[model samples]
Target: MMKRITKLVMVIFLLTGISTVNGQDKYGTEPKKCQQNLSLFHESVKAKNFEGAYENWKWCFDNCPKASLYVYSDGIKIAENRYKTGDKTAAAKLINDIYTQRIKHFPKNLGKVYSDWAKSLIKIGATKDQVFEKLDTAFKADPTGMSIKNLANFFQEVTDRNKDTNVQKVFDTYDDVVEGVNNKIDKLTKQSDVINAKDSLGKTLTSKEVKKRKNIGINLTALGQVEGVLDRIISKVATCDRLIPLYQKNFEAHKTDSKWLRRAVSRLFSKECTEDALYPKMVEAWVTSDPSPKAYIFYAGILEKRGEKKKALEFRKKAIDLETDPYKKADYLYRIARTMYGSSAVSYARKALKHRPNMGKAYLLIARMYAKSANSCGTDEISKRMVYVAAVNKARRAKAVDPSITSKANGHIRSYSAQFPSKKILFVAGVKSGSRHKVGCWIGETVTVP
Candidate 1:
């Protein structure tokens, strides 16, 4: 179905002549002349003959700016080669012209075009501010369409600006950009899930679909890297002391603005500032103004803090029940799990998995919990290290199922596997490497020792 839809969209583009190179009549160039230049440019580009491509590509750019996108595509290649060969000035101007023409021809795709433009500028050694301006324009125009690099870089630049006296801009950009990255990650993960679902049903993907899945994996991996970078950038600015005073100063003025209040309160909660007096007040105000599932979660936190365990559980359940999207419900449950102590975190994480089976991070979370409880799970060293085997099993499962976190999960598996009791120690205990061993305590999963 997805392939059919993709082909249909391609057909539409072809029908509209958007995919043709010879249809540059609107640029006032003769069709035969345009075709000749386009053909020559493509042939040269295909042969890696940037110098040979340059003259023909230049004719298309000068006389037929509205030609097919490949004109710009080949032009960028030529420009990059020229720039690397020391003609930086000429190359920069031509690359900039390519972007301008592409935008003029396809104004609707400004976000992505501008992001590409910003990336080109970075390649040419453009100043940070120049790159930032282009990325900022791209983000504001269409954040979800922007690349992971742009999204993360924009936040970093905004943080730089915040230090120069626009602190609120940093907060605003972080909120918006992080949300955009999450949306993109969710979108790509769903694409992979579709392919994985088919595979699970014994329907192997065609070669084309396999390629598509690989691309999705590549994109998810890139997004995961940017997410870590963004977190590191924000961590420097989001300290509890810095956050509390900043929120305290604006709390009264923005109390009625639920969006603002929620952002403030959520930031505070994430930074573990819930003990502050302002946290409960903001939670109450958020519930009064919006009553969203997120707001209910904050209110639940307030209840938990007051030692009202039963009431907190009820509000938390209400929050989870109010959420209709399985992914989001799982996210709320995951958060609840993060906030909980002892064995209950694993239970909440399991509940999250019940709602969304492909949430590999949930498995990772469970593994971490089991590892944390290893010392108390058994009295003997051998029995305790058996918990590492269970932890490693979950991490391995996560890597097998989730492409987005495959790298991280594999790292966990390696680290935990190393911590497992040596084969010599296992042999002394009458255990074989391939034999099954039950990990007692809250983690009842059986794992094969290595």
Candidate 2:
């Protein structure tokens, strides 16, 4: 009888401990009630019954905020539905609470959360400063996680606040935002290329792949839009007059800073302020401090500006050699080509194409070079005009390879095609429309007589 009583007491204690553990679970003091409400909330959401989901969602949110991420995600949907159905005040309050709770419970994607919160603030007619505060937090947390639209908004806020008093901040913000957007665009472009290739080959994509392709397109478009916005915002303050003075004042302080020197050199180069005395100083400092591929490229541009073509070519070659990324290598080659003319330019452009086969800009650059060389390449009307045909061919190839530049390539094609040899001239030259003709001089390309 004594052994039985002791064993029964031990069993009762264990049962009480189990109940305490269950009560203290993540689902709060009422674990069973929280779980039941969460299930009902999720089911109603799946059924698109926002009105029915609200009570259960509120219960889960109040009782078990840390239960699951879906608590916040589904809560957001419920709030949005409320907003759309004319419950703006209550919905906005709930959204604000949900964002706060989400950050408290799940802070991994804080950048996206902050950005979404900023957008919500905007929708609720919040002040620019308030919106900017959230956006600033988002960008600083994880710029890559922020939407392209939010990035644009963030930059605009920075510009509006600093454009006059702290222009350096504006430039810095512009660089950061543009770099982030470009990185995203580059990534999305690669994904888009793969999916497009598969689709072009008549391969059927899975539902997920199709959705991914659509999202890539949407993101690419948003990135492009943001780029335009950034350019427009910076153009006003990035002119040579403003940039020269700004860099001049800050050069002594930032001379040893490679990043500052690089930005100064890049901005000066872009604004055509290289003619100023400070440009070479920044370039020299950049190369000395960083000595990277981009630094070498900037130094090469300075050398070329000073008419030191041989030394410039060496530095450009050095830049190309230092770069390991195929895309960047191709870009360096293209940049070097842009500094040249005639056959040399075409040669470097072709080298770029070797590294990146779909580099349509290189082909377009070759087309422009060919068109400019038309008169120099041939003496006769027929031969001279045939150069335009070569240009047209390259432009068409550019359009075929890179959809991003189709409009620009089409414009080039239209202009070049107009300059083609007249039918009378072709007939007089005895060159049949379908017959192949070799272009003379540096081009050395075969073309159809048409």
What is the clash count for each candidate, in the order shown? Answer: 0, 0
TM-score each candidate.
0.88, 0.76
Give the per-residue lDDT digits (tens) of candidate 1, residues 1-450: 999999999999888886344455554347668778989999999999999888888988888767678888788889989999967998898889888887787677677878888999999999998999899899888876678778778877788877558677788887886677678888887788888889889997899989998898777766666656777888878888788888889888998899999888888877888888988998999999998888888898788889998998898899899999988999889888988755899999989988777788988998898888889886788889989888888887776666668778988888888889997898898888888888887777787777
List candidate 2 segments past 4 Å from native. Answer: 1-49, 64-70, 84-87, 186-214, 358-360, 370-450
Q: Candidate 2's residue-wise lDDT over 154-211, tens digit each?
A: 8877888888899999898877876776677677767877887798899999999999
List per-prediction Cα lDDT, in the order shown. Answer: 0.83, 0.86
lDDT of prediction 2: 0.86
Worst 10 residues of 1 by lDDT: 19-28
Q: Estimate candidate 1's RMSD in Å.
A: 6.2
Task: Give me the displacement of residue 5 in model 1, in angstroms.
Answer: 36
**For every candidate, C-alpha RMSD to the true structure in Å:** 6.2, 6.4
